[model samples]
Target: MLNQDVLRNARSPGRGFAAAKRGFDIAVALLALPAVLGVAAVLLLLNPIANRGPLFFVQARMGRNCKRFTIVKFRTMSAGQPEGGPAPRGPDDPVEDERITPLGRMLRRARIDELPQFFNVLSGDMSVIGPRPDVWDHAIHYLDSVPGYRARHTLRPGITGLAQVRGGYAEGIRATVQKTREDLAYIDGLSPRMELYILLRTVQVVFTGKGAR
Candidate 1:
């Protein structure tokens, strides 16, 4: 039988952990805010000529326990499109190649598109470490296709994590499942030390421009 009680107990420590992580996030975000905001402002200024309209975009995403929250990102596509043309997919999705704007492509390559998520972290809708969030549409789709997909939601979503550093955009169900395993592995070993390791690796990867679209 499924040990719901054990799983429930597993999260009893989360409230304390969440408080600690929030403090850490606030400290880091405050330290990085000047730089982060500068970069985002520069990008917004350039976007008019590059991508055009809407400095930031928000979409409904699923978070812990399948709760809904709006995710923020730099707009990387033209504002106008045919109704129901195509939904935003993962970075690796073939459709992404078609819908992304020229300047949007560059934003994604440099990960500038994700800059707005810092606010999400500060707001406690996300974290600096954990599995990435998915749009509710994608979440629904994955729940049907991938085993234990919801397990990743045991904690808040993150801007960077084992999955992002390992395999940027899930290639397919197999890849997604693999990423889920990594997320679960992280959950099993969650700690400040382990999170520091993941964060360090994430910084290394970002600087080196590795495993990014």
Candidate 2:
């Protein structure tokens, strides 16, 4: 029988899975905070001249069940455009090539810019592993454009996910669609082993700078 309870089935998790996942997310976030803070301290000291903008870039993102929450990241691009500032950046939001500071490029390459999301994990806004959240505006668009995208939010967003490790960050509509499919597939097969694989794969991606835009 199909679980009929669509949302519950959408998550498709086993007994205590959600609880276990949350516990792990909390543990990891707590343990990692010191390192994140240490790096942030270094970046703070250097931001004045090297980055030339806010130390952190915060934007609203779509969370599980399509709720909105603030997502935090290290500022990796120059601010203050003549027109205004940067626009709402969605998943794989493409920034101007020239706007990427040399330091930002290194952070992106090493995936260090994502460290701030550990706070989101602690706050219950996100998980350690799942689909990366979409920018609120863009997620609204995708909810209308992409089939099965709503299901992607059955679980909290993650700093890393299967699509992210496999395809990198998505840019265009075609890529977003593919990413959505992979996210859904991850949900359908949610398990301990799969999470471990994603964690392991994420390490490789970080080390190799693969799948990063």
Candidate 3:
């Protein structure tokens, strides 16, 4: 059965794992705050020269069970839209494309751009590990187009996850379907060991810049 004890709300499959997972997320987030915030602070100081943009890129995102919440991240793009339109749908998430500054690109590759999201994790708006949250607009599109996409939100969104490690940045609808499958798989296969494995893989991805934009 799906885990009824979500973080302050609904979560997905597994009996007692939901509560345990939230606890782990909280513990990790607490432990990580000092270092992560320090790095973010350092980056904030350097943003003028390297990034030349706002300190953060805040946006509404789809969280567990389709709940909307604001997700915060280090700004990787300029203050406005890349152009007068929405970020395009195809080709490896155009949100990360031409609009992204070079330093922003580096931040994304290193996963440093998302460090501020630890705050989101602490706020119960996210998780330490689970399906990564999608931007509200894009997530709306996927909900209509991709099968099982809604089910992927069975748990709080994560900073990193199986889809992020295995599937990387999913592009269009086909890739999103794959991402949804991995998300559901992660939900179904919840365990301390599995969570640990994902966390370790996240470390590797951070250092090696593999499977990152």
Best by TM-score: 2
Q: Estimated TM-score per prediction? A: 0.84, 0.90, 0.86
After superposition, candidate 1 runs with Cα above 4 Å error: 1-15, 81-93
Off by over 4 Å in 2: 1-9, 81-94
Model 1, span 1-213: residue lDDT tens: 223433333331377886888788778767767877897789767877877777777887779887889888877877765211125554234534566888887777777778788889888898878888876766777777766677778888888888888777665566777777677767767888888888888888777777655
TM-score of 3: 0.86
Q: Candidate 2 lDDT, tens digit per residue, 1-213?
A: 222343345674665998999999999999999989999999989999898878888888899899999989887888664111224544344547688889988999998999999999999999999999977777888887877788889889999999999999787567888888888878988999999999999999999999775
Q: What is the clash count for each candidate, in the order shown?
A: 0, 0, 1
Root mean square deviation (Cα) for candidate 3? 4.9
Which candidate number maximizes lDDT?
Answer: 2
Stretches of candidate 3 exceeding 4 Å from the true structure:
1-15, 82-93
Ten-residue region with minimum lDDT total, candidate 1 = 82-91
User: 74-186, model 3: which lDDT tens digit per residue?
Assistant: 88776675321234543334444777778888888998878888899999999989899887777888887876678788888999999998878876667777787778777
